[model samples]
Target chain A: MTEFEEIKKTLLTIYPFSEEHLKIFTDKLSLKEIKKKDFLLKQNQICNHIAFIIRGSFRLYQKTEQNELTIQFFTEKNWVSDLESLMLKQPSKNYIEANENSKIATISLLDIHNLMEIDSSFSMLNSLIANLTFPTTQISTLKLKSPDKRYEHLLLNNPDWINRFPQMQIASYLGITPETLSRVRARIN
Target chain B: MTEFEEIKKTLLTIYPFSEEHLKIFTDKLSLKEIKKKDFLLKQNQICNHIAFIIRGSFRLYQKTEQNELTIQFFTEKNWVSDLESLMLKQPSKNYIEANENSKIATISLLDIHNLMEIDSSFSMLNSLIANLTFPTTQISTLKLKSPDKRYEHLLLNNPDWINRFPQMQIASYLGITPETLSRVRARIN
Candidate 1:
């Protein structure tokens, strides 16, 4: 499939669009190849575009005084953007970096607004994407769970994450220390 | 202003709806009075409606094996619902209960879908409301901050929350113990 087709497939999964609407929507996207470890977004930058991963993965994270915290992870077919920055036009406090050599199809905030102006159906895309991608309920509740429970929840729901990301990053995402994660894994295994 | 008008005003802040569209949207909402400790939703129940708080406050929380974890708080002008449950039609794992006697204007999921079908502009309402209210960025990063920093962040951004809710609920919301919260407050004061 073409890089753009990857985007089309993802959008189709979210909302069925007529061929014409799909064409109009995908026509605005541009594809780019990114090398592993390169940043798509950095701290204090405005996230002006949302990108769909046609290949590879990315990690969204923030750097605090003491450490870098992994906020979320995205892989093939997932859309990545700081929604807060994209919506509010505020500078983002997070960084989005490619985890491996990657190809992405991206559409800018301007293009999105233009499309929304052209057709009201286009407005549903952002919300639908946000709802599907951000498991807000899970994120809010996971923090309240015990370290073992959190690890078990991840094991049950997103086992691939364990194999794909480094242990330190996964530990950061779980809000636990690397040593705690190691102990949890040993206990669970 | 009528309770429905409060909903209208909140919607206007999010998106400038045409007068006709605004009227059609607001007309579907019904006002309900909730006494303190009454639930708008409970665990295992499907959340079929999203409510706009016109008066008083509510807490969205989950009961864990060890404790109750407050996920979020909603006050006047804020919209409240288990978006995950409402969107997916899954049973909610959280509870939304009034902290004080409250009046809310709520529109059912079916009405929202009907309105979206009637006009594409109506589709923007859910996403816009979610974006304005959830503050997903803050929630993700807040977990990474130290307990004292979290309290200071709240004091700077939402001092009213400190005053309105009891120390226990706020402590739960912050994912800290009440004793820790007292120490944080004492240190800051």
Candidate 2:
């Protein structure tokens, strides 16, 4: 399907709106191609737009005193945005960068709020966030419970990610050392 | 406000529903009270109900071979139910117990499903999960970046919790040891 068509499909999936309402949202969003290593968001920048990945991947990370830690990776058809920063209109402490040549459609926070006001159906958009993003947040808490179990579960569900993302990034995401990840891989194999 | 009145306000805060719709949900939910240390849910039992804590405090914990860990806690007016175990209809691996005398209202999964089908607004309930419970999840993931930072942030946000919850439980939630937590608290104070 065409990128525009795919975006329309996704919007409808979350909050079904009339054709005109859909057009309002689609019109506001512009698809942009980002080259690998391009920065989508930078530390201390207010992330004004939420990008929906049409093609390619992105990583959200933060640099600590010791290391650059990868917190999450968003691949094709996934949403990647600094939610807290976007919501609070504060400068983001984290960074989001393109991992591969990617195509993403961008929507500004103002546009989303406008759409929510225009489309009553969009009111349930919060439901989408609650269901998709909330559980993901829960996964973080779950990870603290058992790192090895969390790692095993991640591999079981997204085995492809291990090959797609760098080992260092994966280790950061898993809250472990790259050396430890290698050892874990060896043991599992 | 009365417990019944508070339920209406909370429900409407997420989705505006008719008084009739509100009654249907409250009807399915039955109220109960538990003393401190009483089990709301126990390990090895099928958790059949999704409960709302109207008053007091409770926590969900899982025991490892080495230690018993607190996964999460709930205070007044929070939803305290295991989504995985409840949704999957499996025996829970964790136990949820009251930390103090608590008043709760609970509804079975079957009833909630029935309520959803009866009122489309209930389908929008997922956002409630996202906003109310998902932040804890997000914080959990974010904490993986820095355990020390997480502990500091927790203290800043929920000062009373330190006194309310056991030192060991707070340690597990922070992904640290009891000794580390004690030391951290000592340093902070």
Candidate 3:
């Protein structure tokens, strides 16, 4: 099936949205092709759009004085955005980059508002996507003590993300230095 | 105005409802009187309800071997719940406790679903509250280096909460040790 078909399918599964209403909603979406390492969003910019990955993947990260910390990863059938920045209309502190050649359906927060205004189903979908952005930050990180535990947790719960992104990025996501991550990997082996 | 009246006013302002619809809605909520430091939610339990603070404050925290960490604080007019755990129907890893002799309007997730079935206004209100649970987990905490910086961010953005809770709890919320927090406070003074 085409990426757009996958998009429509997910929307339909999210709610049995009427095809006419779905068409009316999806028609407003602008599609984009992003090359690897190209930024979908940058720190200090007010993020205006949220996109759903149709073909590839992206990484969300923050660079501190020490190193870049991976915040989130998004792939096919998943959505990505600096959600708070989009909602608050404030500057973002992270950079979101294409991890592979990617295809996504993009919609601005204004368009989302218009769509929500147009239909209750769209509003419900908006709420679902909002819930999705939240789970990443709500739990873990602060509770976990070691990179080993965090790495194992990721392997158990989100191995797909680990497989898709580079090891260095994974190290960052686990909040450990790359050398430390290498030592952890060797110990595991 | 009474807390119930305040709730009604906020709901009406959020999305206008007919008196009958308001009756259907408010009827699902029960008044809860909580003593200071009483647990509203406990770790490992499924958080069944979301409560709106009517006349007091609450703190959300997670206990670890090292120490108990205060994660979030909620006050009057705010809603509190282990939202993700409630949504997932899973055990929570945090506790929520009253910080005052609080009066709250509490509704179960089942009731929220029933309310959604009854009105589009309830659906919109659910979406609004869902958005509220997200901004906390969204940005800046990991990137900020110093306890001093985090304290300042709190002072600037959430001074009301800082003044309401104990210093040790505030330190935990900042991911800092209390001794360091005291020193930071002394330096500031």
Candidate 4:
């Protein structure tokens, strides 16, 4: 339907907000479109906004002296933010870049705090979302999985990640070399 | 002070709970002492409780055919649980084991849900704690740092981990071998 419709649905799915409260929540969000390869956040910058992807995808990564390591990927309906930076008001050490032309609805940390003060439901919703997206549980286990198992796991859970993102990026996200990913794909095929 | 005084202080530090609410919260918690090498949770079992370490420490880890990988460590005042399992009502794949004789205060998931229903403040507190202990952000970045850098970071942030835990466990937690950890420590010193 509309750009905000997906985020509203997502929010309602997490916690039922009163119509008045929902409107208040949505009113605080601002929409922006970014071109492919544009950065949503960069290392050493504070991430002040939490964004819901309305369209397209993003790669959360970090650059070392030798290479860029992809940590996570977000597609439409998914939320993206450097939670550490946003919550702690500290500079982030990672980068969030658009994988394609993307539209996102974002609310600032201050607005979120204000809303939490305005209504307790907003706080509950924030906690529910945080729990739902608890990355440590998944990523910690994923890091220990074999490359083939990791690829198979991703293939089963989020096939769109495999089909939508480039193989190199996917390999980086999986913490494997392109050659290793190729071998895993070949064996699986 | 008392066993729960630390947890109460920790909770109040996160969100200022009214005396009545704080008492209700503490009243619901049950204290248990676990012996060294005792398990709070095991693979394939559902984790129904989130425990606050009132004393001693724990290592959250996953067992593979070859090794047990330490995913996280929780000492005094730190909260421990398979959050994924507790939130989703699913069996956990990781084990939470006491690294020493430990004392903990635990609340069941059902009790937490009931508390949330009783007071919106409980829900807000849940969200705030979830946000505060957002593990994914830290672990994702930690995975990419070099062994020496990782050890240095840990040394600066939680030197108790270095002083208290066995070198082998610390090495496992760092995703490095005991020998590598030795080299890293030697170079740092």
- Give lDDT: candidate 4, residue A116: 68
Q: Per-residue lDDT tens digits of candidate 2, residues A1-189? A: 378777777667756677887777779988899999999999999987877789999988887777886767888877778765665567888889999999999988666655555554555444333222334333333545455665787788778799999998887777677888888888777
TM-score, chain B only, every model? 0.93, 0.88, 0.90, 0.93
Q: Interface RMSDs of all predictions?
A: 3.8, 6.5, 4.4, 4.1
Lowest lDDT block of 10, candidate 1 chain A? A126-135
Q: What's the DockQ of model 4? A: 0.32
Number of the candidate with higher TM-score, 1 or 3: 1
Number of clashes found in candidate 2: 4
Predictions: Cα RMSD each:
3.0, 5.9, 4.1, 3.7
| Clash count, candidate 3 | 0
TM, every model: 0.86, 0.68, 0.77, 0.80
Q: For candidate 1, give the docking quality class from DockQ.
A: acceptable
Descending-TM-score candidate ranking: 1, 4, 3, 2
Off by over 4 Å in 4: A16-28, A108-123, A137-149, A178-189, B16-24, B108-124, B131-153, B177-189
What DockQ, between 0 and 1, does each candidate earn? 0.32, 0.14, 0.24, 0.32
Tens digits of per-residue lDDT, candidate 4, A72-120, equal 8888888888866765567988899999999998888678767766665
Per lDDT, what order, best first? 1, 4, 3, 2
Candidate 2 A-chain TM-score: 0.88
lDDT of 4 by residue, B79-153 (tens): 888877776567898899999999998888667767766765675455434543556544544556488887887
**Residues B144-185, candidate 1, lDDT per residue (tens digit)?**
659888888888888999999999999888878899999999
